[model samples]
Target: MAEDQLMTYAVGEQMNLMALLKNVTVRVAKNGKQYLDLTFEDRSGEITGKFWDASEADVERYQAGRVVRLTGKRETYQGSPQVKIVSLRLANADEPHEPGDFMIHAPMKTAEMEEELNQVIFEITNQVWNRIVRSLIAKHRDEFFSFPAAKRNHHAFEGGLAYHTLSILKLAHSVTSQYPNLNAPLLYAGAILHDLGKVTELSGPVSTQYTAQGNLIGHISLVDGEIVAACQELKLDVNSEDVVLLRHMVLAHHGLLEYGSPVRPRLLEAEVLHQLDELDASIMMMTNALDKTTPGNFGERLFAMDGRSFYRPSEGLTGKVDPEK
Candidate 1:
C-alpha cells in the first residue's frame, strides 16, 4: 500500500510499504544486541519502527533521507501508533518512490501568500524603513518564501516562515488600525522582519536542524545584523533614530529577555509588535494542537503552550447560519 496510508494500519496487521527514512538511530539492548530505532514518513505523518537485533551492516544501510521498502506489523505504544519491523531494505531504482510525498508544507499556497505579503509591503510608507525592509525581502525572497519558521514549533511546514510573517502582518495591521497613534511603518517592518532571521536559523523546511550560525547568534541577533548590513549597503546612517528604533523592535519582538529577546519592549510600537508576534504564534500553536485531536477528544499536551491540552468539539465553531433554512 501507499506510504500515506500507513497511518491507518490497524494493530497486528502485517503490511509492506515504501517510505522515506526520516530518522534512524542505533541503540544497544540490555543484552548488548544492536537495534535500530527508526522513524518512517510520508505526506500523512511519521511512525516509529524498531528493527530489533539488527546487524552492523544493516544499521549502516538504513539512514535518514533514504527510501526503504519494509515489512512490519502495526501496533500501539504509549497511546501512539508505531510499527514493528520484520525486515527492510533500500528501495531499488525501479521502485515507486517520491521524496516530495514525505515532506510537510504550509496549508496556504506559496504564490498566494507572496501576494498577500507584497500587499502588506506596499502599505509601508516610511521612506528609509521601507527601503531597508524591501532590500532584505528582495535579498532573501527565495528562502523567505520556503523556509519553516522553526524546526518543530509554530509554522514548521514548508513556506511557514512567510506564512507566519503574513499572519503577524495582518495582526499588526489590525492592532495599528485600532490605535491610530501607533506607527504603521514601524509595526509593519517589525512584523515582516521579526522572524526574517529564521530563514537562516532553521536548516530548511524538512528534517530541520540548526546551523552553526543559528546556534551561535540566533535569528533575532542575525536579523539585527542583516538590518545593519542593509543600511550600510543603502548608504544610510546605521545609528539614525529610525534605524535604531527599528532594530529595537526586532530585538525586543520576543517580549522578554527570558524568552530570547535581548531586550524587552520599550517603545509603544515595539510593545505592540511583541504582543502581535506572540498572539500569532500562540494561536497557531493552539490551532495545530486542535488539528491533531479527534472531534470528541482532547489534543496532546503542547509544551510550547505551557502543556495545555485542547478539547475538540464535534460541531463546527464558526457559527455559520444554514442558508437552506
Candidate 2:
C-alpha cells in the first residue's frame, strides 16, 4: 500500500519485507565472499541481508548501524530470515528510532526515577561525591536529560543510564540499611554517584552512543578521575575510613575486572551495589525484549542477542503498569 514498498519476493507466503530503512554495517564474512552485512528493520521487525557485492563508492555512502532502504529478495538461512540485497543506500536519520527500528527502553517513570535518585544524592555523606556529581549534572544537564542509555542493547533511552544507575543505588540503599557494620551513608553516596562519568562517557540525543573517553578510559576510570579531582577540592579528612570505602565503590562497582570493575567488590556495600546494578540492567533488557508481541508463543526475534525470540502469550489481558512504578 505504501509507495516505499512494492510486491517483491516473500520470506513465506505471508511474510515479506517491503523496501524500508534497514541498518547497514561492515561485518565479518562468516561464509561466502562478503561486501556488507545489511540489517533491515521495519515496523514488523529487523532482519539481516547480504550485499554480496559492494563497491568502493557504496562504502563511502554507508556507515555501520546507519538506517538504509534496500531492494532485496528474501531467503532463509539457518532456520531464520536473511536477504539478498539488489540495491541499497542510507535511510533518513530524521525518522524516529523507536522499538520499530531498534529496541529503546526506559525501565521506570522518568519523574519518579529522578526524584528517587535525588533522594539518594541527598543521603550521601561524602562531600567529594556530592560536589563532583553536582558539577557534572549542572554542566551537562541537557545531555543528561536527553541522551539515551545506550546505542543498542540494554537501557538505551535518554536518561536511561541514569535511570538504571539510580535504580540500582535505590535498591542498594534499602539493602545496605540493614547491615549495622556498613556505613549506610557513605555506601549510599557511592552507589548514587558511581556512574556519573557516563554523562560524559556517552553521546547522542535519540540513541545513547559511546564517547571517545568511554572507548578509551571507560566510565569507571573517568568517574575515578573525577572523584579523585573533586576530593582534592573538598579537603575532607582523607584518612577517614569512609574515603577508602567510597573510592572502592567507584573502582569496584562492576565487581570484576573482566566485567569492567578494576577491582572486585571487597566490602559488603560494594558487593550489593554490583549485584543490584547487574540485576537491574538484565531485568530492564529482558523486559523490553518481551514487551511487544508478534504472534503465538514467539513475539519476534530480538536483534540485541541474535534472534532470541521472547515468548508472547496467546491469551491474557495485557499486564498493567505498577502504580508506584
Candidate 3:
C-alpha cells in the first residue's frame, strides 16, 4: 500500500498493509485445532487479528515484534474493532520500514519529559525523600523513561511509563495548589516513584511481557522492596517516619486492598497519590478508546473500565483543555 493511502481504518474496509505484530498467542479452538491470536499495530492504532489452523512453521515465522504484510478486512466483533485475516506473511527484508517505525509512543519527546521531570524532582523538599527518589531514578534512568507503564491497559505504549508519571505529577501540582495543606512534596515524590518499578516488572518496550518477578511480586510490591533497599543503601533509617510515609504512598497507590494494594491509604499524601494515579489512568484509557471510535459512534468495550463502551460525542469536544479559558 502507498503511504498516502494509510489512515484510520474504517470497519469493513478491506486492506492489504504492513503492520507490526505487537502481540501473538496460540490457543486451541473448540474443534481442537490450534490458531494464532494476534494484535497488529500501525502508526494509527491497534486491532486484533486471527490466523486459523496454524502450523509450527507459521508460528515461528509470525512471532511478535516482526513486521508483516497482511491481507485482511476490518471487522467488529463484540463491539471492538478487529481484522479478519485472509493471508499473512513476514515482510520482505527489502521493505521500507522496520518494526520500530510503526510503534506508538508517548506524545511528548523523551528529552522534554526528562527536563520536566527533573524540575518536579527539584521540588521534592524533604531531603530523605529527595535522595531516595534521585538514587532510584538515576539507577534505572533509561528503562524508566522508555518502558511501557503496563503490558496492556492505560499508557501501554513506548515511553509510556514516564509519560504516565508526568501526567500524574501535573495533576498533583494542580491538586496541591487547591489544597495547600496537602504535602506537595510527598505527593510529587509518590507520583514520580509509584510506577518506577515497572521498569523491572516489564521486559522492555518491544513485545512487552511480565518478567517472573513481575508475575510473582507485581510492580506494587516490587517498588516497595526497592524503596526499602534504597533506604538501606543510602544509609537512611528504614524505620523513619519519612521512609514509612513514602513507602505507604507507593504501597497504597492502588487505593483498595482488593486491587493489589497491600494496604489502603493511611496518610493524606498517599490518598491523594492514589486519586491522581486513578484519574490519569482512567483518562488515558478513555482517550485511547475514544480516539479509535468515529464521532457519533461507541468505541470498544474497555476491560480496564469494567468492560464499558464509551460514546464519542459528535460535537468533537475531545481536544486538550485550555487552562486560560
Highest TM-score among the candidates is held by which one? Answer: 3
Tens-place lDDT digits, model 1, residues 67-177: 889888888664446898888989898986666666667788889988998888888898888999999999999999999898765877778899889888888878887
- For each candidate, C-alpha RMSD in Å? 4.0, 7.1, 4.3
Could you tell me how far off, in angstroms, the CA of residue 21 lies in candidate 2 after the best superposition?
Answer: 7.2
Q: List TM-score per model, in order.
A: 0.85, 0.69, 0.94
Best by lDDT: 3
Provide the clash count, candidate 2. 5
- Give candidate 2 regions above 4 Å deviation: 1-24, 28-33, 38-49, 64-67, 70-87, 91-113, 125-128, 173-182, 203-211, 237-240, 292-314, 317-325
- How many residue pairs clash in each candidate at the backbone level? 0, 5, 0
Q: Pull out the clashing pairs in model 3.
A: none
Candidate 1 ranges with C-alpha deviation above 4 Å: 1-3, 6-16, 23-37, 48-59, 70-87, 315-325
Per-residue lDDT tens digits for candidate 2, residues 1-325, read 2333222234533333333333456654656444776655443434566766566677666654455556666665653456666666555566542333443335565677667767777766656656656665665665555555566556666567667667777677677667667767766777656777777788763324577988998878887776666667666554567666777888898888887888998988788777877788767665655553333645445565455766755676678888997
What's model 3's TM-score?
A: 0.94
Prediction 2 global C-alpha lDDT: 0.62
